[model samples]
Target chain A: MELLGIMLAVLGAALAAGFAGSGSAIGVGIAGEAGAGVMTEDPGKFGLVLLLQALPGTQGIYGLLTAFFAILKVGIIGGEPVSVNVWQGLGVMFACLPIAIAGYYSGIAQGKTSAACIQLISKRPEETGKAVILPAMVETYAVLALLMSIILLNSISF
Target chain B: MTLETGYGYAVSRLRAMELRILGKSLFQRLLESDDFKDAIKTLGETHYAKWLSDDKGTQNFEYAISMELQEAYDEVDRFTPDKELSQLCRLPYDIHNVKVLIKGQILKQKGSKKRTDLLTKLGNVPIDDLILAVESEDYRLLPFGLHRVVPESLMLWEQTHDILSVETLLDSHLFLTMRQLVQKVGYKGVEAWVHAKIDSENVRNILRLRRTGMDAGRAIEFLHDGGWISKEKVLSLLSEPVEGWNRILGFADVSRVFEGVPETGNVDDLVSDIEKALDNYITDVLRPYRYSTFAPENILTYLWSKEIESKNVRIILVGIANGVDKESLRRLLRNVQ
Candidate 1:
């Protein structure tokens, strides 16, 4: 039972990381597609758009780190078999919540910013700085989500 | 707002929108294009062509870009509900328009043939009315929100003797207003960007002053009051040679752009690079709130993007018409996005 509990926790953490990463992957993929379209029209602004698209990708790393911490430091795997309890399940669920939510939204928002950045770069490859101002606005929340997930993981003793 | 509801819809919508931007390799192709006509043809075959009419000509590319930008801003604004944020989006253009109007006023007063035709497309303010207003109206002539600050800007400008000093003062005033707006709205990301812009502009102004051999006092007077440029730093750099000044300016990251230009040459490209740098910063660093309505940053980003796209197409078209070679035109390309 204890072994099953440990395995469950490890699985939960992996699940969290996988889902969050998927969200980021989808968001970045969309931005990449849009960026390709813009580049087809005006290739000169590629670097700027590429950087904007990268902003949404931060969440995937955050999710991975959270999961890694849970499994490694917290001994979610390769430990004494402890029966998986409701509290442990809730901990795993909530631990993944911030990143999953942040990743899902930030990915989409970053994509929009990337598209806008691509359009701006296409027109004014020189004024790419001005184009970046708004996308960075969206990046803040993603960062906050990552921070929250990290902090929550750190607090969990499981 | 709780996690379950607050920004749910907005985030989904924004995420959907983000998936639509362009990529890198295409930029190389556009840059490598032979001329503006070729660039337009290439773009016409892309997704952006949807925004353009089937009859959209290279001559009207910038206008089409502007319409697209306005539409993007509108969509963002519709998604967000912050009025102050919307107003902030117009601040940069407002300041740009003000500068254009002031320059026009001065030119018309001196009976110069060039009456600020560069900004005829903006149509935000009239040259004639601006002239009349500046000459006859008090600070009260300014919009209600800006009336109080007009006196401060006027005083700063009055104390400056040279053109550089006047320009710096005006910029300081505008920078202050932008900073205030960014702060009031609690948009720290945009705030950082605005500060960076002000810092870049101030550093550029200092470089111009050094090249002109202006006295230390005069140079200090010319410095924009509240940018990242420290007074002591500028004073120290004033005593150094061009390369030394470049090193200090390079520390600011904006100086690397002026590397090729002669110290005495026009700083036209510097400003252009600064604009590009700010745009890049905005696009990469900031992300709009998921459920929040579009703010000032969104609108400003949209507007700046359109303006640059217009300028790029114009340059490309003009180069094609003038029979400029692809290699030469490449050097002229703004190396931005």
Candidate 2:
């Protein structure tokens, strides 16, 4: 039963990395397509396009950090496994949910915004200052999710 | 991608290209230029400068303008996948080329000089392929909408012994193909455009028939089917005079177009006004999609605006060259701004 708990906790870590990383990939791909199109017309706008393209990628890093924290708290690395029972392992798994689900959806939504910003800067490069802010609005949710996941994972006593 | 196609890449590229489009001020500048040479001089400073290399004063300005339009079509084709709305818009150009090729061949057989200069490479079908297809009497070599049209127009000319018959066949076929394409794109704006355009053309044809004293029964032969107005509804207008057209068509709110039709001596001028009203209606229908992301409507509207821009430039340059007053020329311009 205890082994099952440990496995479930690790499964939560896997979901955090897998689902959010996949969402980031899709978002980045969408932005990249729009970026390549802009660069085709004005190659000088590459810096602006690249910056927008990278905005969706941060969610993947956030997901990876959540996974790392979960495994570390359970002592899946560096030391012997913590003596977490079935309920403690279950609690740890639920703690990872904030980033796991939010990062996935937010990543995709930010990508679409970033692609639109890339288009915005392509037409009027002078507006890059504001264009950067449009996609960053979507990042607010992702930042909140990361913060919540980290706190929950650390606070849950085993 | 067929139904939910994303034009993100194409729209981004198009937005940059839109920045280069000549604005109304530039058109007005060309309109007020002192002479043909002066207008050409002002045009030389714009994005059209590359196309102006062959500018032998005013002689080849038309060629430069046509080439610029052709390049716009080429860019849209390159950026969008599938046989998109850009290619559909070129259907008229392709039909125009076919009409010339077939007519040129027939005239050549009759001992007339072959006028190759009349042909434009602005259509989807390659000029060389069109020429080879017409010369070999093989319709299969042409594209979907055009393949069957080549031989059908020839047979039409042979049967009626009237070049008008061939023209009518080609025009109706062009609309038919355009309808098919607009349906395939499954866009509401384009569908509205095709309906309004065909209905507008039908209205014009009915007016011309009434003027010519042609029988009303024969007018049906010239009308196309994809319009929003049913054939019976449009045909019902023949019994009523021109002034009564608004009363009959008012049910569909189509009377709005006919409201501008002058009652007196300039029916021809009123025809242009009706067309202008319909164009404005279409422009309004498409304007909302202008800033939409990843939509084919965005591309379609952009292409239409580019076509409108080219038309205005042509009218201004031609008017300046012909010494028409600026006010009269301004009246002729289609309002999309």
The lowest-lDDT stretch of 10 consecutive residues in candidate 2 chain B is: B1-10
Residue-wise C-alpha lDDT for candidate 1, range B114-233, written one tens digit per residue:
445444323233445544555674546565234554445455555653455455655566667767777776665566556656666556566667668888876776665555556667
Please list the C-alpha lDDT of all candidates, in the order they appear: 0.57, 0.80
Q: Residues A45-97, candidate 1, lDDT per residue (tens digit)?
A: 56766786676687688778777866764454566634445566557657667
TM-score of the B chain in each candidate versus the native B chain: 0.66, 0.90
Number of the top TM-score candidate: 2
Residue-wise C-alpha lDDT for candidate 2, range B267-318, written one tens digit per residue? 6666666666767666666777776767677677777777787888888888
Which stretches of model 1 miss by more than 4 angstroms? A1-158, B1-15, B18-22, B46-57, B83-86, B107-165, B241-337
Worst 10 residues of 1 chain A by lDDT: A73-82
Q: Estimate each model's TM-score.
A: 0.52, 0.91
**Docking quality category of candidate 1 according to DockQ thresholds:** incorrect
